[model samples]
Target: MIVLDYPYVSKFLVESVRDLGLPVLDTPQVRELAGGVPLDYIDEIEFSARLALGGKVYTNSENGLEHVLRCRCNEDLARQVDICKDKALFRETVANLHPDYRFLRVSHAGLSGLDLSDFPVPFVIKPARGFFSLGVHVVNDLADWPATLEAIETERAALNAEYPEAVVSGAEFILEQVIDGEEYAIDVYYDAEGNPVITNILHHHFLSAADVSDRLYYTSARIIETWLLPFTEYVRDVGRECGFNNFVTHIEVRVTPEGDILPIEANPLRFAGWCVADITNLAWDFNPYECYFKELRPDWDAILEANKGQAVVMVIGDLPPGTDRESIGSIDYQGFQSMFSNTLELRKIDYKAYPVFAFAFARMDEPELARLKLALAEDFCRFVKMK
Candidate 1:
């Protein structure tokens, strides 16, 4: 069963839900999006009963996490959600996996009075239940605290109103040492037996140390062959830690200079948000939703053979903060599309309700790595004519 909610849904997902005839939890948002699409829609009562009876579940966005919590009758599943939702709690559950990594949690109201004399410089501070890069900041110097604090508060005010607290909590925050490495995102699910099957692995690309934006992520065949087993094993360990089964997660981690895998966080019950999971189709010719719902696992050996020498990228054209959403404007989507030679898909989002303008998926070769760097550095506001 799937429970989808605001702020965004994708055509790919709606079609997949239709094709598979999966039972969708009936809600105005899902009805608004999936109505007349021939989906199997079920009411809350039936949905909750099915979930309690051990039905496998998936949600398109964390915004739907509220539904899961309310309908949750399984204490173990609820515990898993808590461990994944609360970053401080997550750090505790997995402490045995990395005992030296330190993290501290403080209430939102307590951040200002908190003394950081004992904490290390260059640490990351973010909402304990953050999603996307909202409210996430890297503090490099003591002088930057006031400005960073101001930014966090501004973000907190918006988040507390804009999303469900279960999705992005504004009350509590986590401060942890930065894990320096090339970051990677993995989309994997554990079967009924708790064995993990990876669907996709993406490299999170950034322009510099202070960059926390999710502007660019790309995947290739070589990455799958190299990191698949190690990441799968790591996720298996995490499942054991949480007693996870019949679960799906999109996990982020850093591969340190010394080749250590340090976890960043995990977004449970979904693949990448906002249909970034669809990039799996653009990259490997299979839908992640189809894989999870149908319990189908990719034959990695055969997949890597056909997917070599290609890079499929998920490029987010995020509108900068402070852009007036109601202002009259026109976007030069064509100008952005012209940057890629082989565009796989271009999804224009409702930036009026959400912060992103578009999600562009493209296929590139090794020589075009510089082009991705250009995308990473883009503000994308230049393409917008605000009145």
Candidate 2:
């Protein structure tokens, strides 16, 4: 049975697995574990207090299931921050863990010694333990620190009152050094036993010109070369060191200003998004969602070699309310089906759903590939219009 986390992530997984004709266990598997089944039965578990009782729990190495649950990493890269009651430890650990990483600590009061007047802004600030971009602010001028800190403090106080348990152990704000470089997301898979295999490299594009943005604007496979393979290998090594395997990891990274790839964050047991399988299926001839459930691996070399010119474009836009299928024209079930017979692979297209959108997996034969990619993306987005 396929188990999932919360409903948002679970719905997509359940639907995709069902589409592949598989039975799914919809209940939160954590409940089952609490009820007395062994820990290994749980495929993935997020961090929580009950499981960490007295700081030890049983884990099965054979299936690499233990890594699926949140552990030390949740506290921060240094294993110092506790998801519950350890904010001060978190700030201290994060700073100590990777002093080289771009880090900035924000607070109700400005962080001492980080003057913004200096050129080449080096850091950013936010609530120490904020979510969904709350209280996240960037400071370039030392002059702006006080104002920014005051606003964050106000927000932090409100959040603490509402979610005392969620508050960080320390009252200090989040300070992060900006990692300057291009951003790329690596889709990685670990064997049931927890060894990683690089699947694909997808470039994420942001609609906003600003440097700090959370929501993903668009994604496509732009380039993959032999040099990047080593980068993927390094990520695997890091994952192994962390004691996690048998899951999908969305590792965000930056091509450092010095031409080195440095990891921004590693999500141990989560897919980048529900759309990953769709991107791989459309751009390449393989399906990751299928791979996960069926325990199969696609020949990456062959797929890359065969579909060298193909790319997948994710439409970045919002769907208004009351939108319906008629806006996009009749679902050309037959015409749409015809692409698979050709070289094109259309990933998941939900015409009947809100925020109506479709992705075109197109192949081009010339150096004019860039132009063709845009044309195809436009057609795909237009064809699935939102009212």
Best by the TM-score measure: 1
Worst 10 residues of 1 by lDDT: 71-80
lDDT of 2 by residue, 20-74 (tens): 6543322354333234322223222323332333222211111122232334433
Candidate 1 lands at a TM-score of 0.97
TM-score versus the correct structure, for each prediction = 0.97, 0.57
Error of 1 at 36 (Å): 2.6
Please tell me which predicted candidate would have the highest lDDT against the true structure: 1
Candidate 2 global CA lDDT score = 0.46
CA shift at 32, candidate 2, in angstroms? Answer: 22
Candidate 2, residue 41: lDDT: 32
